[model samples]
Target: MDSYTSAAVDGHLLTPVTRKPPLRSSADRHGPISKLGDDLLVAILIRLPNARSAFLCKSVCKRWSSLISTSAAVSFITVNRAGSTTAANNLL
Candidate 1:
């Protein structure tokens, strides 16, 4: 397709294609999860508006879904977002 049509076809402006590795890679020893490790991913998730990471990692794999739902991870994320739940309760 022509460059002009490609850009205009979608609402977003299109740019020249660039090569990039996939989010996940089986070949890598660290594997696909290397894109965002457990610690970094957890940090990013907590910064989101809500528990959006739970929904996102669900489709990644059953193992990932289980990992995010654990009490430790959930509590950590909750705490990082805005302190303990008790603080929120006090505000309410």
Candidate 2:
């Protein structure tokens, strides 16, 4: 039976199946960053230092534009800018 197991269906059996290769990380798959959840992506975008950069990111695609246009995202940027202004005033 072991010998026949390696033989083809007609009469010969093939070699035993081997283990599967390791899975690739999501970032390694060349998928768009938009595949990430909106909230998560928003968190990442909010860290950009410049509002212009964030606005430019919106034009990358429809999903990104929609995310950036959301009320929460807009408010976040506004708050961030206000905070930066406050920090600059404190430094003066």
Task: Give the top-scoring candidate (TM-score).
Answer: 2
Q: What does the lDDT read for residue 19 in candidate 2?
A: 97
Candidate 1 lDDT at 85 equals 46
Compared with the true structure, the alpha-carbon lDDT of candidate 2 equals 0.67
Write model 1 residue lDDT over 41-61, tens digit each, in one string: 666556655566554765766
TM-score of every prediction relative to native: 0.42, 0.50
Compared with the true structure, what per-residue lDDT tens digits does model 2 show for residues 1-92?
Answer: 55644447666557776899899875566476737776566666656687777888887778789888888787776566423544333323
Top candidate on lDDT is 2
Clashing pairs in 1: 24-32
Q: Provide the overall lDDT of each model, using Cα atoms, as 2-decimal numbers.
A: 0.60, 0.67
